[model samples]
Target: MTTAPTRFAPSGPLTGTVSVPGDKSISHRSLMLSALAVGESRITGLLEGEDVLATAAAMRAMGADILRGDDGVWTVHGVGVGGLMQPGQALDMGNSGTSTRLLMGLVASHAITCTFTGDASLSHRPMGRVIEPLSAMGADVSASPGGRLPLMVRGLAPAVPLEYRLPVASAQVKSAVLLAGLNIPGVTRVIEPVATRDHSERMLKGFGADISVETDADGARIISITGEAELKPQTIAVPGDPSSAAFPIVAALIVPGSDVTLTGIGMNPTRAGLIGVLRDMGGDIETLDEREVGGEPVADLRVRHSALSGIDVPPDIAPSMIDEFPVLFVAAAFAKGTTRTSGLDELRVKESDRIAVMAAGLAEIGAQVEEAEDGLTIIGTSGDMLPGSAHPIASSLDHRIAMSFAVAGLHCRDGASVDDMHPVQTSFPTFEPMLRGLAEA
Candidate 1:
């Protein structure tokens, strides 16, 4: 679906308690793991966004009986390990790269041949990162010329146990290999040179997998999973998505006198780098009622408007907040000094080239931004209202880019807008409404 250009102006003091959607990473894992277990698994707070729903649809097509009730709970009856039936047709993954890669792993050792397809955005993302690992486990694979989507995989029932080392720091690649290990006969090991998000490892343990993780002498992680195992079903309560919460949190920080409370956000250390970076910028963010939910850290964030100053973002923290850099760039544009970030080679491969997209958009809107091959260096406006763009910014079908620009609009003197708002539906379906609610309040 397409949307017309919508402009946003400075709305003073956005005050209210806001609850964002369920965590996308956790939500996708819950559904996939639930669909691989015996009996029924119930999940509350599943993200109903287009990307996550695409994963749900793919699971249902593979013989998992998935149902969502009027009470907002999702129930799934799995086909168990090595029990997935051949799908009747191609699996359409929509705009979710996570679904395509991870599902490829599940189908790698299932004795079934499946074809995966996706929208323009998802189809363009490289699938070779996942295909390489799964193929090492004996899956026959073929993809488009550039190893992009429109891919086919023929699983081998008795796949080989692999000891693959990650070439890049990717949670998706790490998770894909571990998932392919589920139906293999022996132990499958993955050597991670750099630490990434551990949602898969955590949720696998929660669902009764024989998974072990150890840190080596060199700080690399060695993760091993025993195959031919049975999975136990359990009730899962998803935490609020910190990635989605970033928009409003930064919104509250940049707009003077704005005070916003975001409740139930996931504070998983692997995904909390943005919070730490923002705090280091002198942002007024308070953690309230810290607790645990679904084996992950959870908290309510009380954010008030503050004077923010930019610093050199540590490159090591990039993996934790990979999905959040676009908004971080937005936050950087309003800071008091120069904000420089590097070691983000992965940004070039997202749904859109985030570094290029944000740099161009920010520059057009009167911010001094320098684009690099992997990252961007921005000279902030020093809390000054920017002379907003003459025309709408191009979002390039990226949800994060779309939302980041929307947040930038709140402080624009002439207001700001994007060519399309439809991309936000993939991760934050209520983003527009939520912003409207805050404005009206």
Candidate 2:
């Protein structure tokens, strides 16, 4: 596959209503959980992107029969609980840390020996966070140096389930431990000091897994899932990805006289903090037709251009919207005053070093931004556009950074470009096209 450079220039006000792709996180869990259930599971609005495709392929390698209909519906026949066979080849997870970590958990207690591999980016991510707890549960896992990928696992069915306290705030790590416990005969518990997305737990329960959550002192969440549990096949209607909808939402906020309506955006409280943060910054965002879908909150957002002002972001909200920071930084650029964010140590370890990349790119665009070890301090432009420099930002093959600056360029005077837009296929394949369509106001 050839890597391509892409650029975006100043555009007209965005005025339209559009639906984004399916939630990548939910889509991954849908496929995984659906593949774990007996009988047939039907899923609509599944994200047809590279990363989720990797998850689909990995499940297929494990003997789940997954097929797509002419109308884009997915029908999957799961191998059922504890029925996974040892794959003949290594599972290749292409540039998806979510797939790699979560599936590692699924494979942990299956009595199957599986080799897990990935592309260059996913290969570099540390698997130790998952390995530590899964190892404690008696799954035999071995990784490359520094506990990275190209790893292998020999699972022990009926693996021991243990109580885990998260040392960090990662939904992926939390979900991994829970997914691994699905085959164990007892309670599998994860105590999170910082709450992350609860998609896995929510979806697991929807599939008929016995799971419950309780809040402890200090507001930590204790999620317990009972395993040796059967997950009934479900017909899931996946909502639009809030993360994918974020680009257009922010674009509408920063672009002058713009009003864009995004429908079917997931509003799960744990994952919808970005809306609250942006609202606090004086963004003219409205939520209408709020309702429930597939056990998660869903809503339509009508975002109109407003005069944004920067403020201190609550550190506790970091886990809720970790993936939205790159675009949030772009919004910070177009706001007034300084936007200060902390408690983002995890940003350093995402698909790219988001902190360093965002700070550097903002500086390149003539935005006054300061980078810290864990966070950033961005002095906003007070409604003025950044000086888009001649050089293109090096996207580092991360999809969010590439798409974020593309949104920033919509408001910048000189426009901006990215080193590689190909990575956008990982999460939001329709990003460039959707953005272009939105420009037709």
Candidate 3:
């Protein structure tokens, strides 16, 4: 497929009811844990985007019988815990860091050697965080000097379980360690300074693993899992991604005279920090038709345009909305006053340096942004034209960065232009079309 560059021009109010793609995080985890389960696990509402499809393909390469039914449901006949065969070739993970890193944990304990590779963007992300922990647990992992991708992992049989304390708040690193422990002989424990998303823990328990979480006096969470539990397959229905819904939700809140209803969105508290920040910014968003879906909270979000004010975002909330900083920066650009955000070191290690990318993009578009060691502070323009001349923002092929800036352009003085929108396919392939549809509506 050829790469394409696209630009967004300033637009009017966006109005519509739309369903975003299935939760990318949950979609990836469901396929992986289900593939490690004992029987046929049926899943509906899985994201078919390139990143997730790459994960499904990786699972198949690991000997899981994964297929899509004629009715469009996905079914996985897993080889069960410890039953995965040595893959015959390198697992091409495409642009999915979630797949590559999480699968690394799973592959680390088996008696096999699997080489993992990805596209240029993924190749640049640091994999050493995962490698360090897994290596300590007896896995032989070798990577480029900077711990980048295109690495080889030699699994160890009867691997020793480990007790690790996370220096950074990352669900990916925690999930990787826990997955590796599944094939080890003893209990594996991980202590997190700040609680990251718990989808992996929840899904692991649903698949019948022996895992427990406890909160200490210092507010740290210690997760312990006993290895070698038999996993039983169950049907799964993935909730709509809150991360994906964030775009339209913010659009409705920022665009004058706009109202929208986003349905079946995951409201897992860890991922709902965006909603909290938006509400505090005085956005008129409400939750209706609330219920549970597939072990997750789901709700229909109704948002209407409202005057927004900036507020300080606590560092503690960083983990819940780590993927949302870029979009939040967009919202901050249009709000009144200044918004301060901290505890964002994790943002630097994502698909791109999100903090740096957003700072540069926001600065180019007229928002006064200051980049700090761990976060950024934005002085809003209150919907005014950017003071300086405008220029196109470089996306570096980061899908979230591209989409966030596109949304920002909607409210910019001179609509923003982004280079290389082709990377949007890695997650939300329908993003541009969906945004266009909203404009037409």
Model 3, range 1-441, lDDT digits (tens) per residue? 655456676577788888999999999999998999988999998988899999998889989999998888999999988988888899999989999999999999999899999998899999988999999999999897799879999999788899999988889999999999998888999999888999999899889899999999999999999998789998999999999898888777777778888899999998899999999899998999999987899999999988889999998998899998889988888889999999899888888999998898888877889999888999886755453324668897799999998887777666778877878888888898888888889
Q: List the global CA lDDT of all models.
A: 0.93, 0.92, 0.88
Give the per-residue Cα lDDT of candidate 1 at 7: 90
Off by over 4 Å in 1: none
Residues 304-403, candidate 2: write the lDDT tens digits: 9999999999998998899999999999999999999998998888898999999999998889999999899999999888878658898888999999
Q: How far out, in Å, is residue 230 in model 2? A: 1.1
TM-score per candidate, chains pooled = 0.99, 0.99, 0.97
Top lDDT model: 1
User: For residues 245-339, what per-residue lDDT tens digits would candidate 1 score against the true structure?
Assistant: 99999999998888999999999999999999999999999999999987999999999988889999999999999999999998999999999
Q: Which residue pairs clash within candidate 2?
A: none
Tell me which residue pairs clash in candidate 3: none
In candidate 1, where is summed lDDT lowest over 10 consecutive residues?
A: 1-10
